[model samples]
Target: MNTVRSFGFLAKKILLLSLITCWGISGHAQEQRPNILFVISDDQSFPHASAYGSEFVDTPAFDRVAGEGILFMNGFVASPGCSPSRAAILTGRYPWQNEAAGTHASSFSEKYTVLPDLLEEAGYTVGYTGKGWGPGDWEAGGRERNPAGPAFQDEELTPPHDYIRDTDYAGNFRVFLEQRPQESPFYFWLGTSEPHRAYEEGIGRAAGKKLEDVEVPDYLPDTPEVRGDLLDYAVEIEWFDRHLGEALALLKERGELENTMIIVTSDNGMPFPRAKANLYEDGIHVPLAIRWGEHVAGGRVVEDLVSLIDIMPTVLEAAGVEHRGEYVMTGKSLMNILTSSEEGIVDPSRLAVYSGRERHSSSRWNHLGYPQRSLRTHQYLYIRNFAPQRWPAGSPRRIEDGQLTPMHSGYHDIDAAPALEVMTEQADDPYFNRYLHLAVGRRPAEELYNIKKDPACINNLALDPEYEELTQSFRERLRGVLNKTGDPRVAGDGDVWESYPRLRGPMREFPAPEWVLPVKED
Candidate 1:
């Protein structure tokens, strides 16, 4: 009996060895451990995918992922904006823990631990294509190489594309997969630049997307133009989904699909006004799906209060590693929930999911930003904008392709798009100007919304005397989370802008405020 058992164990080891060589890597630590294939999408909102019930576009690949694994309807980002959210994911710590990484332009510090660095130390071959954790300082974070993996050799690998075409993700992923070692288990992050701004107009229409099929959210006016724009965004999302499909197919062909853990999610919400930069549902809420064949139950929906920060811990746990104390990380591993028949490990409505934004770019000289802290529960949404004086859309700096026009087609805030046009015209009337307060005008210290009833958020219940009690409750809740999480907004009096640094990007000087004289003027 002992000899038979030994033979069976040896046979399994030999089979594993054969599979390892095929993926260009070697054997893993254990049979139960699976390689992580994380896919991150940029600027995608939950409402854009069919799995989350988006009327705008059809996401077959994303749906396929959800159908084959677990779909998280309540997935959210740690920050309303990109840089901070990503920092939280990679560091396994809140934005607050990441020093300057808390806000945009606040660089990530090297003293902190990082995901790729940690995984690489554990003997995983970590290679990333598309977007790696970014929009901040990875080099300063002690990530000397682009891959930032422990196994990274600067001469052998290059940083993934900073400027990426929607379809380029698959090609980069292919290269990463082809270059990996068969014996070494891998962790590959497929960051896709999709559904972000600067997309070709009419792309969705070209994809056979009907204008009528798109559901215009209440924030934007329902019009052919807006619908068309949304469809265009959908086209890019579908493009991203195709990349996922291609990667999955390759994994299957290599016989590593079953042993690979897949996580598909987006960085933040759609890049639209009152959404992207703001701490609204459209800004923070996102779609997420996880699949680990024979491990995570298929066709399950977990409506839990999970944030992007949780992803790092979950990945560590999935890799058969334990994250012990002494490291103050707030993220929780969802491994048990994924593998179990449990409906939802954590209640979606149990706690308030918090998000805030700091300096995004060097719109101003002093790194002034529309800092805000928000909490979203099952019913209500609360926001505390620290810099009510600063423009939430941005500091009115002309961006070339972003907020600037003509040469770049400045798209948001003051754009002539149908939605903005309609809303702008509405401001002409006294009623709408007040309503437009929700859109652009200066907000109070606290803004509250009952999302269940007013999804468009045209009304601010904070000022309404009748809803004062509800508003106050949300305010207290927001403060409590801020206090517990050590968010600067609570004690900083929500003045996060005072501490954040300005962006030093190429467009820094171009968008310099008119009030400031150029060097030539001196």
Candidate 2:
């Protein structure tokens, strides 16, 4: 129960989450409260940054943030997948409550409270650049806050669809700042698109990156191709960091850094197998750093377990604003933690931190996913695969044009590793070889791992007799929360999604499963 804070016995688990988990929110807001620079990167992993001790790619800007403020070593996203993770960060509610935003293709419900909108209400100007609130739309929920800001009147700029030059995030951010209302405290989300995907192969090599400089995750095999791909990923990461540097430098040049609370972190785990789309540490764990001048002590590293939902409550606290009682927020400020005012975080009794994924990428048919849920704590991590019968990635079908069709094929953790690459490539037919065990393989419905012993989560302790004690406890913990969260399947169970009026879209028409697809009558 070593956590930031915890509530007493509540029904259905009371949406257990922690504030410490949300990345960013470093400095003191009072000194710098109204001016908030929230920067988020897509699909970047913790191991890529030098601040976290990555020798491969040097992220001086990211490291600078950590150096100037506080670096959270135990930060986690409520839901490891993107859409839901963003929803939790903004709304401070678990994905199940934000049902519309729960899945990849689904839209975020307008009924939820978005942080930017609240900040605007509290008299702060707000706007965003590049990859604001998506993978899906939020307009369907009947709210017109496209980026959900009453303060969002400035020009809107999104990142490039394909690679481009100076026209990326920083340029668009400049446009936002130039158009911002005069003499008002402004909140801007500088979301970067540098490191997501579709990089020109060997792009990093051309940039003078060395393969030996690459750091490989234990889950993936060490090989030249994997290292090279990692280097390519590193190049993009550096590009993103440099953008952050430029933004910080701009704030300083404009006399804003000292009074600006800068919060920077990634959306979810690295975009790799057993990482991005899964609920393992590699998926949910992220790097977090924050800075505030003369208030939040610099050079602090806290290990208290925290979750994304706590963001709203913390930011609200920092901004000297309350939740208005009309809206119930699930997060608390780590202000005390940052200031080291509290002796030690009370066993926040974070019964567990939870995450799930509904869909990813273009291949899923019938919208049937690798559907999964997981719970993480200091001792162990437990996962429940709702649809163990389905492939984690889309099935064994050959993707149309690119390597990305098989989503797991390019996972940075295990993506393109020599073992996976050669094993897949040399096979007679790509349809069977490409996806292989990475997807479409049968798996146990319940999995338990000793997170301390196996951080990568490679060992399945659920079925092992030696770990039965650990398995039972973890299973019970997950079941209690899921049932409390009103997950239908666990309670003799039904689908909570069934109670929800399922949103309709062309996404529902994903290719039908082979068994269900009719042989063409033609």
Best by lDDT: 1
Q: What is the C-alpha lDDT of each candidate?
A: 0.68, 0.65
Per-residue accuracy of model 2 over 1-522 as CA lDDT, tens digit each: 101111122111222312222123334542345577888888776656888888778789888998888777767887766677888888876676566677664677766778887776555666676666766666676766555342222333443223522335666556556655444567788876667665656767787888887776666555677677777777777877878998988888778788778888888876555567677778888888888776677876666677777767777777876564543655556766766633224336544677766555443554455567788887788888877765665555533443325433422223333435544564455543433453334568988888788887777888899888887877888888777765555755434443333343333223345566679886
TM-score of each: 0.81, 0.81
Q: Which tens-of-lDDT digit does each residue in 36-153 have in candidate 1?
A: 8888888888867888878766778788888889888888887766677887887777676566787764466666677765665555666665666666656655556543342211
Taking every candidate in turn, the Cα RMSD to the unseen true structure, in Å, is 8.3, 9.5
| Candidate 2 local distance difference test against the native | 0.65
Model 2 ranges off by over 4 Å:
1-32, 148-167, 324-327, 341-351, 398-423, 427-440, 488-522
Off by over 4 Å in 1: 1-31, 146-167, 324-327, 344-350, 396-437, 493-499, 503-522
